[model samples]
Target: MRNIKMTIEYDGSRYLGWQKLGDSDKTIQGKIENILSEMTKTTSDIIGSGRTDAGTHARGQIANFKTTSNMELIAMRDHLNTYLPRDIVVKKLEEVPERFHARYNATGKQYSYYVWNTPVPSAFERTYSYHHPEQLDVTKMNEACKILTGTHDFIGFSSLKKTKKSTVRTIKEITIHKEGDLLHFTFIGDGFLYKMIRIIMGTLLEIGIGKMSPEHIDTLFESGIRSDAGMTVPAQGLFLDEVFY
Candidate 1:
């Protein structure tokens, strides 16, 4: 048997999400599993590094699958691309140690959100970014990002009400960059709770538009109230950029 690690990239515009859904055949995981199952002639359970919400994209999503077949990595990758939808592709494939687990062994991840900060509509960026026609103060957004970059119990920033897992997670850093009418927000973290990144982005956006003050970030931290944080931004603008081990 061999343990194979694969990196994937997908548009995620038409798919339901990364996880396999009993409700739909248009899922990233389901598409890949079907191809792998045929190639191995056995059950092929692929473990993803993490899950992305519906309509969310991934540039370097990672997964690992254990297979008894002796298929070469290059042939397997080419075969997967041939059968899978054009929107999804296998970027890299290789053999890894047996002990490597995609989800459990992941040490950190980087998520990015894109915003089209212009009054003019962009046909090209309609599906890839959030279009905000109103003016935004980029400086204020960075101020809010600075306050959010640290270890904290982020229950206030998540959509989940209850869980046995800890909501306390460390955000190693956050970097915001703007060029012309485009804004990019990058987050590097140990881990994120459910909908945590979207919530944070929404709050920062409110700050950028003068709807919320930067000081409100501290209030949310102290209060731990989900409603007090911000809205849950659309999943379309979010991307799982990279996963680190």
Candidate 2:
């Protein structure tokens, strides 16, 4: 069998998310796997770097699958793209070492969130960015980002009800850049829990508008209660930027 690595991009507006579910076929993984199964005439299983939530976009999502076919790499990529929906595209594909697992070998990931800071929303950007009418204090938001960086228990920032796994995650950096009416937030981290970025973004935005303080972040870390943290922002604005190995 030959191991193939793929970089995928998709507009998550209509899909149910990345993972393939038993009850539904409207998924990124399901769509790609179906095509691969038909192409190679085998049940091909793809392993992704991580799962992006429903309606969450991805620019550089990584995945891999093993197949016994001897198809050329470029032919495989072109064939997949030719048949996949216009909204989803396989950006790159290549053969890799047999033991190279996409999920297990991933070292970190980068995610970006887009926000429209102006009072009037952009008609074209409605599906790509979060619209916030209230003026945000970027300086204060950065202050909160400082507290949010580093290793910490992020159970409060996730929507998970219960898990045997540890909730601790390391956020390498958090930055907000303003370009006209758009506020771009970038996060580089070793890993993140469910809805962690959205909740953290909500908290930072609340802090920006003076509804919360930067000092409160420490309290949430200690509390480990989901309700005490900020709301889970809409999934439309979040994008899985890149996965590192």
Candidate 3:
């Protein structure tokens, strides 16, 4: 058997997110696994670096599967692209060491969120950006970003109800920058909890609008109160930008 590492890019507009669900066939993992199983004549379970919420997009999502087939990497990639939906594409594939588990081997990940800051909503970007008409103070948002960076227990910012797993994760960087009518928020982290990035983005937006102060971030860290953090922003604005090993 050979371990195949693959990089995938997807629009994610119509899929039910990355994980394969028992009740649904409209998932990224399900689609790829179905194609691979049919091609290889055996069950092919692919492991993703992490799961993206439904309606979210990905530019560099990494995954891998072990297969008994001896098909060439290029041919396998071409075959996957041809059979999978147009929204999902296999960007690259290569053989990796046997122990290279996609999820467990991942060291870090980068996620990006986009906001339409202008008064007029964008027709083309409607599915890709969150539309916020209110004027945002970019400088104030950056101040909040500074507070968000570094290591901390981020339970308050995630949608996870409860888990024994550690919610404490290191956020290496958080940056908010404006490009014309758009506000781009980038987050690099060792790991993130469910809906953590969206919740953090919502908090930053609240800070930008003067609805919350940057100092309030400290309170959330100390209190770990989910209700005190911020709203869970819509999933469409979020993107899995990259995965690092």
Candidate 4:
């Protein structure tokens, strides 16, 4: 058996997220599996490093599957791209050891949230960015980000519906950057709970708009209550930037 790993990028504007679900739903993983099955003349299981929510995009998502075909990496990539829908593409492909598992072996993940800090509506980038007309205090946003850079119980930032036994997660790094009218929030973490990044961004944006103070971040952390944090940002603005093994 030959194990093949692939780097994928997709514009998630139309799909129902990455995982395969019911027959009525269209998904990234389902689409890829269909194409692989057609090309190789056999059903194959493709495993992704992580699942991005509906409307969330990915720049460097990683996945792996096993196949017996002696197809070259370059040929397989080109073949898959030809069959894949326009919103998704196979960026790279390589052979890997049979023991590799995409999700189980992942060490960390990096995500990026983009906000367009302007009043003008972007015709092209509207699907991929969050537009805010109000002026954002970048300094204040950065300060609030500092409060989230270490291991902590992120119960306040996670979805209240989560049933996980533990809400504790370690954030290895958080960086805020701005260029022109674009504000980028990048987060690197060992793992994340559902909607955690979006909630964190929403809370920080409140601080940027002067609705909340940077010091309130500590209060939210201490409260361990979901209501204390800001609203969850839209999934379209979030991107799974990379998955590290």
Best by lDDT: 2
Task: Judging by lDDT, tell me the better candidate of 2 and 4.
Answer: 2
Sorted by TM-score (best first), the order is: 2, 3, 1, 4
TM-score, one value per model = 0.98, 0.98, 0.98, 0.96
Residue runs of model 3 more than 4 Å from their true location after superposition: none
Residue 14 displacement (Å), model 3: 0.6
Please give, for residues 1-245, the per-residue lDDT of candidate 2 as tens digits.
Answer: 89999999999999999999984879999999999999999999999999999999999999999999999999999999999999999999988999999999999999999999999999988999999989999999999999999999999999998889999999999999998899999999999999999999999988989999999999999999998888889999999999999
Residue ranges of candidate 2 with Cα displaced over 4 Å: none
- Backbone collision tally, model 4: 0
| Window of ten residues with lowest summed lDDT in model 3 | 139-148
Residue 46, candidate 4: Cα error in Å is: 0.8
Q: What C-alpha lDDT does candidate 1 achieve relative to the native structure?
A: 0.92
Model 1 lDDT per residue over 1-40, tens place: 7999999999999988999988478899999999999999
Candidate 4 TM-score, true structure as reference? 0.96
Q: lDDT by residue for model 4 over 116-231, one digit each (tens)?
A: 88999788779988998899999898888888889998988988565658888899999988877888889999989889999999999999999999999899889888998999
Q: 101-165 in candidate 3: lDDT tens per residue? A: 99999999999999999899999889999999999998888888888889999999998888898
Error of 4 at 28 (Å): 0.4
Tell me which of candidates 3 and 4 scores higher on lDDT.
3
Task: Sort every candidate by lDDT, greatest first.
Answer: 2, 3, 1, 4
Which pairs clash in model 3? none
